[model samples]
Target: MNWPQSFIKPKYLSLTYLLSLFLTLFFLSCEINYDGDERLLVTGRILNENNLPIPNQDVEFWIYKGSGAGGDDDLISLTATDNNGQFLMLIPSPNNEDGFELKISDPDTIYQHKILHRILDKNFTNYEYNIGDIVLYQHHVITNAYITFNKTTVNTSLMDVKFKGDADYLVWINEPETYYGDYEPTLAHDYYKNVPLNSTLTITYTIRDNSTETLSTHEATVTINNENLEYIINY
Candidate 1:
């Protein structure tokens, strides 16, 4: 004997199926919602105290424990600040409570001084951060070196040069070889090392500009192995 279809199916089974389908579609069409609260989105522009946008800055947000989600470990990572110092990021789920960190640095010398700090905010877009201008301090040389050589040996020593500026810098030294006892250009845009006795050697050092897209140049000359060589730089 076969069971009747109506007897096998619950009276409200069809209605239940339709209701579930409707709910799923509705939720999918709408924005995120949980625990009776709607999702929140925030964004904003980053600017320095000088009113210029701090390009290439890093911006990140984290969770706040007291606000509900526990702490930083539960935080989400966001994108870096754009060339215009603008950024966008999603808020956390559940409590949606969070904080953020802003970091700005020099592209050239990552080791140079930097600005970093944490900001406590529930809404990032609603807030405007006025980070001050990132001023890079100049480097100063504490000591200078001048190397000379004689037959059978090389001379190493320091020279006292008065630099009339407040700066921190790196010094590079080079020894060029020449055919005569006087420093001269033996190669175009190139210099050689090591020379025989009676050949002149030109030793020079120059300071370099420690910045992005720029370089500092200086040169000096000295006699070595009876040759004088010309170099475009000395430190």
Candidate 2:
């Protein structure tokens, strides 16, 4: 039985190898389950058309439970942007078949609301997702018009102005709502208002002469486009 030491199986070495294999299997099982209380962090920024940060803006996050349009939405969190237009929040990781959405609104009525959607699978582990900058556009058009009278009189004044446009167009006259004083007759008046972008706008101007009791009106039609923010009208 004492042939040589090399022919003998070391019991200590065999036990050490079995213990290492058991530890490896245990760690692998823990990773599969991922049974931890860790959360996912998300951060982003909001900006306007001028590439400026929009501070004190509200942002919302929602999670989709089911599939397709019939899915139920679960509100996760709501936060506001800081002075620098930065936002950060933490939410639980969605299930393997779930999705998420983010929404931001323009409360000042200067820009349009933004909504983004994403589907996060199981591959997305505990990590911080930075969405960078989200830019919004101006919802309405700021149109300005300048007026000139064909014949200037001592009692000439701007009476009023009216605007008409296509079915989807909305117009509001902002300046010269009332008649100007005869002593303060001016050659120009600015008509500034917000209207829908990319539409046809028809402007009508009214001029009055107190002494002669004469009322004059003029009409002009112009197509409002993104490039034409401000417009000029002659009467």
Task: Say which candidate scores most in TM-score.
Answer: 2
Write one digit per residue (lDDT tens) for candidate 1, span 1-235: 8999888886657888879988877544342223334334546565543356656655454433332232223335456667876766655443433334433344544222232323544323433334333332311211222233222212222222222221122211111122222322221222333332332333433222333323333334433333333333322
* TM-scores for the candidates: 0.28, 0.43
> Candidate 1: where are CA atoms >4 Å away?
1-38, 66-72, 94-235
Give each prediction's root-mean-square deviation over alpha carbons: 21.2, 23.7
User: What lDDT does each candidate get?
Assistant: 0.38, 0.61
Task: List ranges where model 2 is wrong by over 4 Å.
Answer: 1-36, 67-70, 122-126, 141-235
Q: Give the distance in Å from residue 56's predicted Cα in candidate 2 to where it truly belongs.
A: 1.5
In every candidate, how many clashes are there? 25, 0
- Candidate 2's TM-score reads 0.43
RMSD of 1: 21.2
Q: Which ten residues in a row have the lowest lDDT in candidate 2?
A: 167-176
In lDDT terms, which candidate is top?
Answer: 2
lDDT of 2: 0.61
